[model samples]
Target chain A: MQRAKAEFDATGVQILAISTDNLNGPLAMAARDGLEFPILFTALDPSIPQAYGVFNLFGDGLASASVFLIDKQGEIAWKSIGKNYTHQVFPEEIIEQVKKLN
Target chain B: MGAVFGRKNRVLIAISFVAALLLLTVACGDNLSGPSLTSGQQVGAAPSAEAEQPSSAPTPGAATPAAVAAVGSESKSNTPPATATGAESKPDASAAQATGADSKSDTPPPPIATAVSKSDTSSAVAATETATPTGTPVPAPAAVSETPAPTSLPVLVNTPGPVAMLAPDFTLPSIQGPEYTLSEYRGKQPVLVVFYRAYW
Candidate 1:
């Protein structure tokens, strides 16, 4: 994510990450990963995940690993809902799809 | 004497025939004019002239009639101005030069923000002089530009709130070490609050 942000800094794209982890966990993760971008902690907020239609109730009782490509027009251009965290989509594919939007 | 005269005559005739053939070859070559030098020159020169003429020149008359229609279409298409037929005549070198010129034109001179800190001595003297001139009263210099008033950020609307059907506002510490409230940040920038399990 940091590498992607560096490449896209001048392209006027902003990335905001949100995690359901507790405050301490998210802060530690940010510090360890050296993440320069913003990360919002939802404090295990199930409502947020459910609203985005990514909540996996049977799996982890949280949102699945999903990538949503929202275009400049605020429309969802592409979405990939991975079944498991290990099957998460790559960032390059997300970028490729996003580039087509603009 | 008869035999010698006949041999001399044959030799003279052969030499004369050779000389006449050489002269004829030279005359024929000169009159042919080597396949029209002017036409060859025109063929070489035509490409350059065509290149100098803008690619759109042929379509200019048609373009004018649809100028109004094109303006509406162009904004939606995000067509590159560089690809326009009229712009193609510009050589790549000139295009680069034009880009540089455009960048320079668009860039404004640096504001006095940086100079304000370094020239404190000069500013103090100037302030003293101004105070002296207006002995009765003088207003302190106010900032010309306020910290650009925070812009209203976009927020996701029509999404269910934290409460049933009501999007609940929450506060979370920002990665920048400042605590941010979703409702507050929403007024400045759209917030996409994703809730994902870290372990899973």
Candidate 2:
């Protein structure tokens, strides 16, 4: 999202992030990272994560750390499932791979 | 005691003699069989060459002096004819050319031309047979536009219920310090509703 914002400033590629994280957590993370994109909270809805297949059945019923590259056709082009929440994908690789689809 | 020691020595000598005879036999056998086995292998390998004779014999006739000269001129001319058989025989022509050059032949064969001609012919034939035979001439590919057309925002469908969608209609305090409802902004432009949780 950060790379997209930087590289595609006038290209009109808007980044919309959906999070199942609690209000405070998502807000604090966004603020800390200085995110200019819109991060929407699903109001602790379990169905949202289940629908996206990123739902983890553990404590707090939080969504797993997964990166999905949805193409312009609304098709999932690439997806990565990280075992741990901290094992997130690099933004550069995602941007690079997304550029190929374009 | 002396008789027993002498008897033991005699037995040892006999054993030594037998061992020497066995070694001599083995050595003699190797000398006699080695060359004969090699000759037998040569005889076996001769038929393989004989089998290859017909293929090689036809090639020289097929690659006549006139044909070789034509190929040489084609290679020098830089316009190779396309043919499948010509392509297949290119490597042979190339090798022959190389050998001819090494042997200082008066006329060096055009090896590359022969190969290229063959490839071109085969490729042309294959293309003609398999390619889409549309009656109309193929139009040139469309030029890519520098500026892409503006994409319309996806229409958010409202399910008939009170269920909160991603961009639910709500009256919220705007960044410009005015209370805004989604319905008010509906006619003018697309309103992106972002429901954010406050940390501070």
Candidate 3:
């Protein structure tokens, strides 16, 4: 995600990363990795991710690498959920998707 | 007999010290954070073409050139351990193990992360849950929250959700910071929401 930060900024798309980590958890992570983007913690309702169809319902409340490109109208313009955790939706393709919405 | 044994012990200690120092030297020379300068030239666009866009097109996909540097360094610095371990194990096995250790040790953070994730992967069920085309028949974990499972969560997200449809607006708090509303970004610009497992 850091790699695509500039493209996101250029295209006027907001990037919000949600995770199951608690407050201190993501704080420590952000400081350690120098993460510039906002990392929202979803520890309270574990189902926030569930609603998005990214939460692993079968395991502890953990999220998959699910990405959604939301247009200005708040609708999902493009989204992807895959079997491979490491094989993330390519940033280039995301940039293309978001750019298309503009 | 005592004198001979003492001398051998001293020799063994010295050998251990030399080997440890050699290993430290090898480690101190390799920088794991940035790509090797040697790779700077060979990596496409790193030299000149897209230097201005360091983070965009060039940096994220650096795994390739980093792998190249790893290969180059492995071939060169992998000799010492083979020689050291040759005193015990066969040269071939020790050499292989030596290269493996070289690769593992030089890359510390990733190994630690993988070790951690591997150990606690049950928290994620390895992410190959059903409703998808994976082989696992792993039963869904006992649902523990008030949030109801979306009908489209498991098998149905394959189709893109409609455009201009109201997304699930969220009002989640940041780590020790103010709360954010997902819908706030609407009517202004595009918003890309990224949902990941954990920061760890």
The best candidate by TM-score is 3
Candidate with the larger DockQ of 2 and 3: 3
What DockQ does predicted model 2 obtain? Answer: 0.05
- lDDT per residue (tens digit) for residues B1-200 in model 2: 12222333334433332332222223222322333222223223333433433344333221122222222332332222111112333423333333333222211222223332333233223223222333012111000110111111011112222221223333433222345444454333332222222221
How good is the docking of model 2, by CAPRI class? incorrect
Q: What shift in Å separates residue B117 of candidate 1 from its native position after superposition?
A: 77
Name model 2 segments beyond 4 Å from true.
A1-4, A8-12, A57-60, B1-200
* B1-200 per-residue lDDT for model 1 (tens digits): 11222333334433332232222222222323232222222223333323432242332222211221222222212122213212324323332343234322211111111112112222223223332434112112212111111111012222323221223445666656666554554323333333444622
Q: Between prediction 1 and prediction 3, which has the larger TM-score? A: 3
lDDT tens digits, residues B1-200, model 3?
12222333334433443343233223222323233323222233223322322333322322222223232332333334424432433433443344344322322222222222222232123121212323122212212110122222233335443224457889988764878889998899888888865432
Q: List where candidate 1 sits over 4 angstroms from the true fold.
A: B1-200
Chain A TM-score of candidate 3 vs. true chain A: 0.83
Model 1 sits at a Cα RMSD from the real structure of 34.8
How do the candidates rank by TM-score, highest first?
3, 1, 2
TM-scores of all predicted structures: 0.37, 0.33, 0.44
By lDDT rank, best first, the candidates go 3, 1, 2
Against the native complex, each candidate's DockQ, computed on alpha carbons, is 0.13, 0.05, 0.31
Compared with the real two-chain complex, what DockQ does model 1 have? Answer: 0.13
